[model samples]
Target chain A: MAIDRSHIGVVSEPREIDVEKGQLRFFAKATGEINPVYFDEEAARAAGHPTIPAPPTFLFSLQLGAPAKRGDIFDPENGIGVDVRRILHGEQRFTYHRPIYAGDRMTLTTTTTDIYDKKGGALEFITQKTQGVNAAGQLCVEMQVVTVVRNG
Target chain B: MVSPVQYVDTAALAVGDRLPDHAMGPLNRGTLALFAGASNDHVPLHIDSDFAKAAGMPDVFGHGMLSMAYLAQMITHWVPQERLRTWNVRFMAITPLYATVICRGEVTEIFTDNGERLARLSIGSWIDDATQTLGGEAIIALD
Candidate 1:
């Protein structure tokens, strides 16, 4: 089944999330990060950070905390209609405007940027761009993800 | 325990210089489960063999984000996390279970952008069997 091209440019409702120190530590440990700045607040301060700065790529996980709105483009039924099993993460990109600290609150919004197919419709791709802005209204990060769905 | 960190001198860096390789794994179910919980990505395809088999994979595989995280760790080891301007990756292949991954990066270009020196690096992660599972690029501000 072909994805709905009309979904392009659709934006999700903004979601707010608090960055927490414990969660950052957990993520650091999970990824085998040994950097003290990611684990110890004192070390982070010593390293010239205001607080425990989020490790690189940590924003990707933080964005996932937002609840998926039903009938969104990722939905298997009413949205793109591709089965969940068929979807694969194809590409991911992150452009950081500023460092995100653990004490910050970020507002995240995702927009469907593009939709297309390849391999004669055997592979469908959905591109979505997500931005995280701090409470002060400064953009902290921009992430673009490409999702590939296989059709048989 | 806080470990000793050696920050890279980006000003002294030259193009074609390779960052130290960061290696992790022989990834197991525990790592996948821990990552799934920590990252809030609970997709069963990473943790459930049955689900992966049903999805046409022989077994559960590592998440691309997990590999990307490792790559991020590698980049930060060379420079500060705050120095990262951009990072990107493309999933080239599925990383099989128990495959140890080595993340490597090479500085491809160095130049000044708006008075801040920056280094653009070509980065990728290779499995123990030498399969390049992910390819990516990163740009970092040099102090």
Candidate 2:
């Protein structure tokens, strides 16, 4: 089945998240980041950050905390109805306006930006754009994700 | 010991300069499990061999985000994290289990935009056998 093209331009409700120091440390370790600013508060402070700054790409994890929109293309019942097994990550992009500290609170919103297919419909791609805004109402990051579904 | 924060020397930088290579893993199940927990990406395709087989894959594989994180580490290792203005990657192939991935990048262009010096880079991650698994571009603010 084709993805619901009508779902394009749908915006998700704002989802809020607290950027925790522990999560930042864990992510830094898991990714083998040797940068002390990502783990040590004193080092981060010395480096001129308010606290442990989030590792690059850490926001991608936080973006997942957003509440799933109804009729999401990934949904099996109300949307594309494709098997989760067939889905693969296709692309990811992040544009950062400023470094996000662990103590910050962020409000994230996602929009379905595009839906298309390739290889004669054997593959389908769904693209979503997400923005993270700090409590100060400043835009902190913009993330774009593309998910590919193998129609085979 | 704390590593001092550092930035790429913009004045001496030139197009075709290479960023230091960053390598991680002969990625095993433990790494996958840890990444799954940390990244909150608990997809069965990445951590469950049976589920992966059912999905037509030979075995469980690493998450694309995991590779992306490693690529980010590569960038931050060369320059301070705050210098990153934009990062992007396209998943070109499935990173197989136990593959040691090396992330690499080259400065393709350098210019000033809006008074901030910036560099554009061609970046990718490859397996030991030289298969490119992820490819993309990144733009970083330079001093």
Candidate 3:
């Protein structure tokens, strides 16, 4: 199915998350990252981080899991299949305000910024605007992610 | 067991110092798919080889974040695993997984003030077959 570019816009759905140390450590281990800075707080502070720093890609685990809107780009009935086997990661970019540490509770509001059809697939550009204080609410980390959709 | 020590000596680093070349690639569908699942980004572009072929791509590509994650792995190797405070990364273009890509980084600047040490580095991923699929940079903080 061909997609109309104009249909793309902001997807305003609210999602909340609380950062957990164990989960963050799991991410580090899953990625095969053996950084003590991620598991040992003393090592982290000794190394310069205020606390154990979350991996750059670990932010995805914190998404609020809100449902994508109807008439939206990746909606199954709208054309794209929800099947995991049919999809692949097209590209991802991250901009960080600060390194995420354990105990940071945050909320994220993701908006679909753009959707375009290129040759045989669709591109979903999403901007996840997140804002929340750290355990002390002293710092905030904001990020945006882009996903590609292919015809399965 | 003694944990591995992956560290960078900010005092020893200079602007334009390039990291040793690290190679990764010939990516498989399984790795890409699993990465998507683990990352909660189940987009079809990386998992569906058929979908990618239909879309005119040579083949399925790796997750952009996955690539960035791999780059971060390199940083972990260079700097003592314990010193990283925070890091930010960005992507310039799509990197394919069909061929080997050489990931490289250069220290752009290093500075310390008030007992805090910091370094800004420019990192990139280049296709071993060609200088294509150029990636991005990382700003890292250290103790």
Candidate 4:
């Protein structure tokens, strides 16, 4: 089956998350980041951040904490109908308007922007847009994520 | 595990300048599992060898976001994390397990807008020193 084009423009409910220092530290360490600002409070303050500022890809991790248990669009019930076994990440992009710090509470909203296929529908591409907003309702990051599913 | 934090000076950059490349791992299962746990992306294809083999893949693979994180590490090391104005990448091929990949970028363009000096970086990840697994661009601002 081809991807569900009717699902295009579908938007998910807002997912609210509180940025945690320990989580940030874990992410930093896992990704091999040795920046003090991610581990030391005083260093982060000295660097002019309120607390530990998340590493760039940290927000991508936070996005996974979306209220929905299944964050991937191709999950069985997301209505897109792509099998998890065939999906491959296609493209990932982020436009940062400002830094996000630990101890910040933010909301994330994801929307399906477009869906199409190529190679006689053997590969389907789904493009989604996700926005992160700080507690003050400021736009912090705009993430453009694409997933490609192979149908054979 | 951590390199010294060195901010990239726009004054030090010009069109076609090559930024320092970040050599990432001979990625193994342990590293992949740790990343999956930390990132909360425990997709079976990344952590389950059996699932991957069932899917016709040789074994578990690394997450694309993990590759993206490597590129981001390169960017953050060069500038303050907050100065990253834009980032983008395309996952062209699967970066298989235990394969070493280097994340790299070059200064492709430099310009100023609204008093912000910005640099455009052409970026990619290369596997086994030959195959380009991912490709994209990023923009950073130096005020």
Candidate 5:
């Protein structure tokens, strides 16, 4: 089964989160990222940032605070009518307009941009984009996530 | 053992210079679980082996972000975190658990664009098999 093309352009509710130093530190450690700017506020300031700037790719973790709940795509009862087992991550892209600092509250808005298939419906790819804005009303990052579904 | 990002002087290096390669793992289940908790991506493909097998996948596989983290490690280990402008990755293959993956990158070009000097790099990771599990390019603003 192909992804419901009609689901394209659907926007999810925005999720708000407060960036925490300890949380970022834990992520940084788990990724084996040792940049002091991610764990030390003073070091970040020394580098001209107001607070600890999350390391690149750290925003991925923050987005989980508002992942798509069942039914949006996987809920058979009400969702886009696709099997969860057929999906795979196809691509991920991130663009940072500015560094996200510790203590910065952010709002993430996720939207599905496109849904297309390849090889006569054997493979389908869904393109989704999420924009993150800081409390100061500045754009922090834009992440594009792609989900590929295999239809047998 | 978190270390500081060391800024680099672009003039000091040549276009052919290879950035330091970060060789990581024998990645195990424990590390994969820790990454799942840390990244908040509890996707069953990376955490639930039975679920993955049910989905026709070979047990549970590592998250693509985990390999990206390895790429980030290669970058931050060599260049200061602040100097990095953009890094994007394409998931080429599944990096299975317990496989040692080596992240490698080489400076391809350094040029001036719109008053900003940037270095372009061809980055990839090798996972035991001859083929790379992940590959992509990156642009970093120079100091």
Candidate 6:
């Protein structure tokens, strides 16, 4: 069967994820980052942000959608054998439209962009892009996330 | 003004030591493209100079996860592999490619769970020119 090229740009349901302080704080410590723009509200304000901005890699927490909901591409029931334990992060890439702030409201939409069959395991690519906007409708951030799956 | 922290003793790094803050430069399209090529991420938004302008960005942007990975690389580079059990990260903000960004981290809590010492870590990257860009926490196990 030929791969459907149109599916690459297919849109999925909009997933909403709230931004909070504690989780952002935890992420900062875990990555060993000390940028004041992530922690100091005053500093962020002085720097012209609405509030303290979270780190670049914090997009993984936003539950854009579940694997099953992603259809046969990530379907654990039938399509590909879904095994979590044996999986390793193959790679991740991000392209930002703007910066994000603490009080920003974020909406994530995920699409099963692509899938490849490897000799050892199936390599799946999931792209979740979160678009954040302030109350003023100004775009604050554009976050893109990807992950790899391996048979456990 | 923020003051740089000088750790007196490496052993004194408890579960709550915060690293000194540092400033990065203004990000640009050229730098973002460099990172994209170096990391093998060729998304048009990150490399195609014209595409970025079409998308309304001044220039191509950097990969947020790449920035996160940079911090991860820093941690592993500073600490030995034997002291690490596992590492993971998430990208929260759009770290523009050529934009200058400040990366920093802190130790929140440390504990021994199931016969393994673990460190709760927090880290983030901020666009120096802009206000906020990215941040996240990690769980590190010590052997």
Q: Judged by lDDT, which candidate is best?
A: 1
Q: What ranges in model 3 sit over 4 Å off?
A: A1-13, A18-26, A36-53, A64-105, A111-129, A132-138, A145-152, B80-93, B110-118
Local accuracy of candidate 5 as per-residue lDDT tens digits, A13-109: 7788888888888877776666677677776777678888777787777887555543255556544656767777788887778878888899988
Model 3, range B60-91, lDDT digits (tens) per residue? 88766766766767877787533444444545
Candidate 4 per-residue lDDT over residues B45-127, each given as its tens digit: 99999999999999999899998988888887788877788888989988989888798899898888888888889999988
Evaluate all candidate structures by whole-model CA lDDT and list the values in order.
0.87, 0.86, 0.60, 0.84, 0.79, 0.52
Cα lDDT tens digits, model 6, B1-143, are: 56222223335558668655444445565555554443334557667868777766676666665566456444433443224333445544566554666767788888878886778667676776545555666555544
What is chain B's TM-score across the candidates, in the order shown?
0.96, 0.95, 0.78, 0.93, 0.91, 0.73
lDDT of 1 by residue, B95-133 (tens): 999999999999999988999889999999999989999
TM-score of 1: 0.96
Ranking by TM-score: 1, 2, 4, 5, 3, 6
Q: Given candidate 3, what's the lDDT at residue B36? A: 71
What does DockQ come to for candidate 4?
A: 0.77
- List model 1's recovered fraction of native interface contacts, to 2 decimals: 0.86
TM-score of 2: 0.95
What TM-score results for chain B when candidate 5 is compared with the true chain B?
Answer: 0.91
How much is the lDDT of residue B110 in candidate 2?
93
Tens-digit lDDT string for candidate 6 (A33-141) = 4555556777567656677765544444444222224333334543333343333344444343465556556665555555554545444444444455545666544
**Residue pairs of candidate 2 with colliding backbone atoms:** none
Comparing 5 with 6 on lDDT, the higher-scoring candidate is: 5
Candidate 3 chain A: worst-modelled 10 consecutive residues by lDDT: A123-132
lDDT of 3 by residue, A23-44 (tens): 6666565455566777787877
